[model samples]
Each structure stands twice: as structure tokens, then as C-alpha cells.
Target: MTADHTPGRVTGADGPAPVPAHGPVRAVGVLVPARDERDHVEACLDAALTALARLPPEIVTALCLVVDRSGDGTGAVARRAVAAHGHTRTTVDVIANAAPLRIGEVRNLGARTLLRRLHPVAPERTWLLSTDADSTVGPDWAVRHLHLADAGVDAVAGGIELDGPGRLGADPDPSGCARPPVPDLYAANLGVRAAPFGEVGGFPAVVSGEEHALLDLLRRAGHRLVTGADIVVRTSARTQGRAAGGLADLLRERAAERPVTAVEVPAADGG
Candidate 1:
């Protein structure tokens, strides 16, 4: 395997050490992991490029796409999209891995590649943002996270909304009215500084629940995690998902459990 494609050693979650305060975000890295997402990859890249355009020309930005075990031409599609609509301030890196790796491992690979591309910039001064190939970020997505980082927040956990057919409903009450679902922490909308991320040993190597695991480490280490109410990303609502225990799987389970018409599906709010 080439050096860039080779998997790096994962940092262990050795007991909680004091995480240093971070400085303003001088560089931003957007890590996207895709597997058989040919249809959604272009739109995802477009949305990200638009968001980067909104940032100042001086802020160095990198969009690293790690395509893992995709039968479809997701990697090629991403390259075409970036070549057509890529921003001047943003550099795009597309890495393809045919090995059958889970989403978390693919994400870890993307983070390591991005960090390498943004070298010389201290990890604390760099902001690492993550999103799935099936998700499209808002125009202010990067701005909102960067603002929090500038204010000394170590991480930002944003919310997500399903875009297509299936509507997700929370547990019903005695009155059979489904309560308004609370904003959730979604990997589709998460941001963290490169320093604390490395300190917490990056993401766990699981297919699912890696986001929760990484966040738990941050919390235990006393790192600040600000909920970005204004930073919600729109994710695909298709039932056939790539990850084994992902949103699509949850949607399928919910559908199997109850009648869709019986429960009121919340218009927004999905993890």
C-alpha cells in the first residue's frame, strides 16, 4: 500500500489528560466518508464547496474524501464534482480503498490524510469537520462551528434532518401524541479541533456509535462540547444505508415496529 493510503496507528484513550485551550481556527478540514454513494456524492461535494466559498479567502481549507469499498464510481464522481465546482481556497483529496472497512475506519483515514495536507498548522489551530457522503451541509455550517472554535470551544455537536420519505418519530406518550424530538448529536454534523481529537485518540474503530464514543471521551476529558442549534445538516432518508447500524437501519427498525400512519413523524430532527 502507498504511504498515504496505509492506515496510521490509532491513538489509545490513555487516561484523561488536561486538554489545552484551542486558538482561533486557522485551517479547516472537511472529512467525508463514502461507500457506494454515487448518487449523493456530487450534491454533497457541491454543498461543501458552497460552504467553503462563504469563508474568508485567507482560511486554508481542505476537503478529503475517503471512498471505502464502493462498487459504484463514488470516487470518480467526487473527483469530477471537485474539478467542476471546487473552490480556489479549498484543496480536494480523493482516496479510494477497496478493502471492506467500516465507516469509522474510513473516517479515521480521512482525518489522518487531511491533517497531513494541512501540515505546519498546529492541530489546535485547525478545525476538523466531518460529514457523510449522503448528507448536504448548510451554508453556515462551517461558519457556525468555526465561530464556536474561535470562542474557545473544543468541539461542536450539531443536529440533522432527514430529507426524503421516511419520517422518524419519537416514543409516544399516554395521549398517543409523539412529542417533539430533541436535537440529537449526529456524526453527519460534528466538528472538533485536531488537537483534542488526537488527544482523545480520534474515533473508535467501530462501524456504528463511533461518534458517541469519541464524544464521551471528550466529555470525560473535560473538553467543551457546544451544541450548535443553528448548525443542522440534511441527510438522506433512504432506508438502504451503507453502514450496518446507521440511520437507515434505525429507520427500517422503526418502520417494522409500528404503523407509520399511527405515529406522527416529526418534520425535522433526526440523529
Candidate 2:
């Protein structure tokens, strides 16, 4: 899947553009965990809302933005963005976590809220899509997930590209270049089947690497996972980020050092 860097459009490889799925989408929910993201939340939501608007009118789409102990106007900015672009058919809920919660917990909270709102819908039909506040989704993000679900994939580990200068020294090629794959699972761009996600106990409570942890859980459970480049998201390159030991930290460390042989970073399991 080639990413069209154009702000709102994303096209898949060698085919006609994918149309939104027909029939009610059991229930589609986007889970975003944010903290002090006042500068980037609007653009993030703008890109998300545009992708969602293309879904069939009957699909019950919702955006669950969990503001995790934000000191700034993150929640306010998110609410305003939703009001401006969220469709009447879509439900937009902004839930605040008064105390600081780890990334995993924040995402779990958003998922739970979405589950409650979409309770009547069967879990098998429900889809939970996650992205970070600092990232803007491509136009076909949701559409690609739906297509994968239709093709019987239980979860999707989508790819991401650094949006700015900070990048890990190990990164082999420039953004959008074809290259060998690694365990690049990230919450910045991931989607899951609600039933399997619930079965795996959702995201584990971790300070970081929660996305990979969830991927491991799904893999252990024998779910069909699709790791693809078709649904790449553009994420932040800031070194100082909301979570410690995260992508931001790695980027910062790499930027500080000269390019060297990429070290084998251990997975969350310490493998």
C-alpha cells in the first residue's frame, strides 16, 4: 500500500479506490488516548473524521477520545474538533482520566467506553481502531481495516512513518520506501476485532510497549493478524513525549548518536 502524503487522501496499491463497506458496520469505534496534545489533536481528528465520513450512512461510528490527565486544553480542543466535523450519525465522547494513567490503561478505558455504547452490537461485528493524538490518520485508514475484517483478519498491525526529523538511527530506508519488515506494531495505527480483543483481556497495563504487548496476546491466542503497510499513519517525531521508553525516547537517543549498526531492541517480552 502506497501512502499518498497528501493530507487527507491514502490510496492502496494497484487497484480502484476502496469504497466504504456496505450494510451497518456492526459498530465502528476509534479509540484515541491523549494528554497535552493541544497542538496536534485538531488535525488528527480532522483526518479521522474525513475517513469516517466516507463510511456508509447506516454504519454506527463513534470516536472515544480519552484525555488522560491532560494539563493543557487537550480535551477542549478535541471536543471542539468533534463538534465541528463529527457527523450526526456518529457518536463522539470525550472522557477524562483525572489522574495520570499509563498508555495501556488509557486505551483500555476508551475501549470500554466504546463497548458500552455499542453493547447491543455483537462483538464479532464490532471493530476497535486505535491511533495516537499526535498522529494524523490517512484517509483510507478505517476503510482498509473494514476490508481486512471482511477478508477474515482478526486484527491488523498497521505501519507508521515518522512525520518529522527525529528518527531512529536504525531506520533502514526513508519514509515510504519498501524494505524488510520488523515487529513495528504500534498503537499509533492499529485495529482489532472486538471479540478477540475482549478475549485477550484488552491491552495490558504497561507504561509503554502496550501495543506490542497486545499484539503478542492476540498472536498467542491464534488470531489471524494482518501486518500491512497499506494503512500507514504519520506519527510525531518529538523526543520528549507523553510516555517514557517509547518511540519518542528511541528517536531522541538515535538522533543524539551517530548512525551505527542498528541494535536488536528486545521485544516487550525481553526476547
Off by over 4 Å in 2: 1-25, 168-182, 259-271
What is model 1's C-alpha RMSD? Answer: 8.5
lDDT of 1 by residue, 145-214 (tens): 7776675667777767778556565678679988766335678888998998999889988889778788
RMSD of each: 8.5, 7.9
For each of the candidates, give the backbone clash count.
Answer: 0, 0
Whole-structure CA lDDT of model 1: 0.77
Error of 2 at 234 (Å): 1.0
